[model samples]
Target: MERTFVKDWRGVHKAALALILRCIADHGSPPSPAELQVATAAPSAETVQHMLQEMESRGLIFRDPGSGSILAAYPLSAVPTPHRVRLADGRQVQAMCAVDALGVALVFGQDTHISSRCRHCRADIEVSVVGERIGAYSPASAVVWYTPAAVHCAVAAEGQCPYINFFCSREHVKDWKRDLSAPRGQILPLERALDRARAVFNPMKGLGGGPS
Candidate 1:
């Protein structure tokens, strides 16, 4: 999937998107339209809902069909996923994918502990993020599988997030790929994966007033 930097958004849009991410990081769920209206000082709930729809259209977020509650706000997912992230403040949340787990620290400007399983072997993988640097990770050979979604695809959570995953090692990545007969995805080193994540999430810091 294409990464959107903070510079690409309008001020209000940035603040709104930042607020949504902060809400998920702090409360383990996305904010309701009323909450977003109050936090963003949007004119009304209808306006907040419209903004959310715009964000969804831009692929910055995803919402439920019936209730319109946010299902995802980029990297973060309201529902549980394979990648779990524990923030510096002890709050735990789900990430949309492996790279999203790596991006959590940068987005929140806090240390993060990511717990996930290798896609192929189901081996537990633990990664520590201190500031913007990767602290320690198990199985030193751990790698990330980056599968970008098709350009015309709608709803990244369905198209791309499920495919990006952590593998215990390069060999396991190959094993899983061959067994599933999946198309080749980029095999990224942890550091390079972190770099890609930073490009996608780091710029949002300080945009929505620091999480509360």
Candidate 2:
């Protein structure tokens, strides 16, 4: 992990990317950095500029030159990974988590949903590519209790990828799904989502006696 991002990431040059990561951890995808600067009430223009440079040098993020927007990042791996747990409900969840390059975790998860994170980098300037992990079940494993609005999604009957099968309350899953658009809005690709869902999530060493 890069020390630059931690000590002075609240608002800096690439503040857009830092904000993006925070937003993604919570809402996933987000408004532009300009919009974020205004929203977060960043200190000064120079501060934002410096932060961007710092992020780029550290290789914590990727960026889009044209749009000047932050791409996704491994919040934990990029920063310091947070912890994930499995619950008795048979779902894996992380607390306000993010994945870094090595895949570190960050504690997140407020209410209803969590905020995701993204990074901005100087490399890959010619292209526009942006990107963007979690957990098992336990008494404390229930993340919905922390977020309150958590619903359930059914994972693989055999107990695979906790991200899709992470087990949100059906109502919560329905609520989260309702936010999607059209075909994508109604359906969730747990399997596909699993591909990107690794890092932060860890199934219980021994859990899940049945399937959903």
TM-score of each: 0.85, 0.31
Worst 10 residues of 1 by lDDT: 1-10
Compared with the true structure, what per-residue lDDT tens digits does model 1 show for residues 1-212?
11232333365577777778777877778777776777667766777777778888877887878888888876788777878998877778788888888887877777889999998999999999886788899989999988766211223544335477889999998989888867557899888889878777767654323323
Superposed Cα deviation of residue 137, candidate 1 (Å): 0.6
Global lDDT of each candidate: 0.75, 0.32
Q: Which one is best on lDDT?
A: 1
lDDT tens per residue, model 2, 70-146: 54333321111223322222333332221111122222221112222211110110100022122321222122111
Choose the strongest candidate by TM-score. Answer: 1
Q: After superposition, how far is residue 144 of candidate 2 from its true place, in Å?
A: 28
